[model samples]
Target: MSLFAKRIVLGVSGGIAAYKAPDLVRRLRDASAEVRVVLTQGAQAFITPLTFQAVSHQPVHTDLLDPEAEAGMGHLELARWADQIVIAPASADLLAKLAHGHANDLLTTLCLATEAPITLCPAMNHIMWQAPATEANIHTLETRGVRLLGPIEGPLAEGESGPGRLMEPLDIVAALNGAAGAVPSIAALSDKRVLITAGPTREPIDPVRFLANRSSGRMGFAIAEAAARAGAQVTLVTGPSQLTAPRGVTRVDVETAEQMHREVLARAAQADLFIAAAAVADYRVAAPADQKVKKTETAQHLELVPNPDILRDVAALSDGPFTVGFAAETQAIVDNARRKLTDKGLDLIAANAVGEQQGFDVSDNTLQVLWSDGQATLGPAPKTQIASELIELIGARLDATG
Candidate 1:
């Protein structure tokens, strides 16, 4: 398969494998890719920019503040220039920065600015790679749809054989080829209409303010993307979030719980499957102020009224789609999910813990899925991976029952 004229941004971070970056650039070039090199500050200590420039025959981008770069918009320029990004020797620090959305350097900044798919070939010591924090960061990156090539099991720079070695240059090239659609595809949900809800609904408190939850909508968005990849006709009804729509899916934006309810109910009749992934607000202001509520000396007691339950409403439909619901709970996860699955007339329910670190705004998640006759556990992975697994399960159940 030809990768002719593909624009590739290869990032070299600090590690002993930094020396191998030039070889990686050469391999990409041999595949007919136009490659640009971005050297992290630590990478400069191991492999000089001159070596990369000499090998790739292109200017190496390192500094985030270079003035000569496209009118001092160097980072933005590089971000927009790439079709794909491959970061080899992705250090622990770099991974942490990416996981937490830090953009202190050009590499991390470009990763954030670019719309391109990212592939990270992590190179770290075994202990560091296996550390809880590092694994968490890796999970976060994966959840955000950043593809990881291995820190495969092999000899490490410390002369100890274990996981953490970067994948070989040629192997990396093959992975890149697979990413570019040269590999055979999975069409599990072909021709199925999958309707999904996502993100946290915002309940207005006033004209200028609202109440919302901590949901990042990552899990829901991940499911939508996975369903699209599975060749399902997907419609995403999302609340306020900064996420982009997945390929081949339609997105309908809504805010308050009532708005999401209307959108989901309007489209639920046409769907073959319905996944209620949104963290819709349970309550809203009984009567929102027409103007911004003025701060008062006396404490104000805002009254809250229960919002319409979108999941229950959809599941109550006479011939509704096979419905799935999500229960993000702090305790009794399985019991609660099972109860919801029954009470809401859902075909399936997924339960997970939500706290400061485990769920909600965090990158990775774990799930316990419950259905009338079966169950599955997933995650402690990138939410995208979890979504992929969950979508497969959904497909299987549909196939079995259909």
Candidate 2:
């Protein structure tokens, strides 16, 4: 579980992106969240209440005037139920209603009556998003301390492209986590420095060919976000992964295992905690071809050499940071993780299975955390949730040591 278990009310407004509500519900549920779905009448035009009911495993609340539900003022009942209310695909009309404190519908009525913090994810055409009215409404909401996730620039459903696209569901989750104080700012991390390596390192066999894992750096990026939220000053030494640097962290991008090793070693001395999450290549070409090797009908062989063991090297440092390593295994899960924990001298090792539907290139993941003292299992959930739990555990251990 996350450090906090939240009761989230997801309000779906009318928009083409209503189709994604089910995914949002699934993501939240995977994080061990208690979620309730409420939809506007306009929302039914895009997605059915049945879709939300299936994912949230709860009755969808839509009608503003259901007699039974309104026995005690249904909008007020729901308003009090939420720890947070998130308006996704918060359309142009919805923003206008919220900005003006309109209560014509159940969604607006709840928004007006609720004391929970409101978050909005605006999705619309670029022109609609940029119109003077929409911009003014967004400004008003922000001024009133409402959290805004995104109107990220992207290709729109209208066959036109600009900065009116809704943020990805994962990013929305991150934003919510941020708002809930899950990720601390650089000021929070100021007392302790963090070092993290992410993405997959390449091992070249020839001028044009190399070996690498399928790691997309999502997990590491999520960890960085979690760490930042916890108030740690983070320096991310990453390999090539197409991920934006989390706000308020320093990022250093590297390409090969050797390059990453140098960067990690240099930063480890100043770090209070070090997470070795990069999927580094185990071996590299013994000798590289000067030119790109052409395909041939004949069989061929290439010599290989071992790459530097980054975690072990950091662990061996005279005054190294608290070290955490990752074990991506195929079988013998716990045993293999324990072996790695002992062999690498890591303070902690997080192990996960990798194959067809397991780890690597997935938004969700599970982990087995092993240490000299004990072990804990996390997830069968989103990577973000797993990351948050891992950080909390680490914080507890750090407190114990102190």
Candidate 3:
């Protein structure tokens, strides 16, 4: 079946977006998805379950321990029933619950139990949305591989204009469908926000010397170009590279992994998709010497510390983004790549071998793309061509997921 026809559970938490739940149900139905509604206790206060029942033609599930809930195993039943779990108007409370892995209620408990892809569409006041606690929660969720949609910038109910608006039902559907590979529009990612990290980070050892790589940033740049051409709002967070940014793509350049980490986390929750292709330095000089060391010194024992794992951190976010990671392995290509995919909590990972012949500082590339349950391979072609095919695969995989 088309991914859109797959079963979905619409999780309505307490928020103004609760009022929009009926429209959301209708929209999912229109997409041919079999959507079941799960309302939080707070959500019931804002909108009646009957409203959802009227549109979905299925009973709404609300209580965690209700006897009427699927032979009294409602939570478990719903958990297994979902192909995707969409928490819309995901309030601060809901975000917090998922971030800390607190299954205190049916909605949160279902999130913990389901193997389905989870997408959170946050809605709240601008200040609360931007609060440090909320941002931290978002970062945690994203790192865990949950997909986060928009709290788009616009007028708010609290007489403010900023970044805490629940996404429109159509836009949310488009985002979900786009990721599922069902993007019917040729510009499948049109209006979708995409964040990409590329190039090699420089880890400094001294004023004059630093650790670096031979990455030319071509693959990441190509992906950004293809995404922009597909009508996505693309943000490129690149390490120091000689290449220029693609037209219509916003570029943010940094020299170190730490900087890249900050840049990515700051904007992660706001994105619909995140592709991390940067060959970030795994370690940096723990204490980079302020001044260059003089020549003729005995063998130096420079201490090194691990750099922030950018992809892992991004994947850690609770409602982060549709994250894609790239694995550059020199041996055991599939096994190593699959390990990274699971280890990093990525929605998808592109694996390729790197050496003098195939990848790294090369003009062409190839990839073995892996999701949690499937895989695909792209060619040993030019980086540009490889990027196009990879982007297509990404769209398809995303379309297939939640």
Score each candidate by Cα lDDT.
0.85, 0.83, 0.84
Summarize candidate 1's per-residue lDDT along 1-402 as a digit string, tens digits. 345789999999999989888999998899899999999889999979999999899999988878787486989888998988889989998999999999998999999999988888888997998899998998788667777766656677778877788877866775565346222224546888999999999999999999999998878987887787667899999999866565457999999999999999899998888999999999999999998889979998889999999999989999999999999999999999999999888999989999879888765689999999999998566575577678878888887777
Error of 2 at 27 (Å): 7.6
- Of 1 and 2, which scores higher on lDDT? 1
Ranking by lDDT: 1, 3, 2
How do the residues 1-402 of candidate 2 rate in per-residue lDDT, one tens digit apiece? 241578889999999988877898887787667889999998999999999998999999998999989998888989999988988889999999999999998999998999888888889998998799998998798767676655766688999988788878875774465346223333324468999989999877777788888998878987886787577888898898867565556999998899999999888888889999989999888887888899999998988889999999999888888999999999999999999999989899999999987899887899999899899998776676677777877777676665
Instruction: Report the number of the highest-TM-score candidate.
Output: 2
TM-score per candidate, chains pooled: 0.60, 0.72, 0.54
Clashing pairs in 2: 183-229, 184-228, 184-229, 184-230, 188-231, 189-231, 189-232, 189-233
RMSD in order of candidates: 15.0, 5.7, 16.5
Worst 10 residues of 1 by lDDT: 178-187
Residue 110 of model 3, lDDT score = 93
Q: Write the per-residue lDDT of candidate 3 for residues 1-402, one digit (tens) a residue.
A: 134687999999998768987998898889889989999999998999999999999988888878777476889989999988998989999999999999978999999998888989899998998899998999898767777766766788878877788877866765576555322322447788999999999988888899998887878987886687566899999998866575468999999999999999999999989999999999999899889988785788888888888889888999999999999989999999899988889899998998877788766678999988998888766565567677777777767774
True-structure Cα RMSD, model 3: 16.5
Q: Report lDDT (Cα) of residue 185, candidate 3.
A: 28
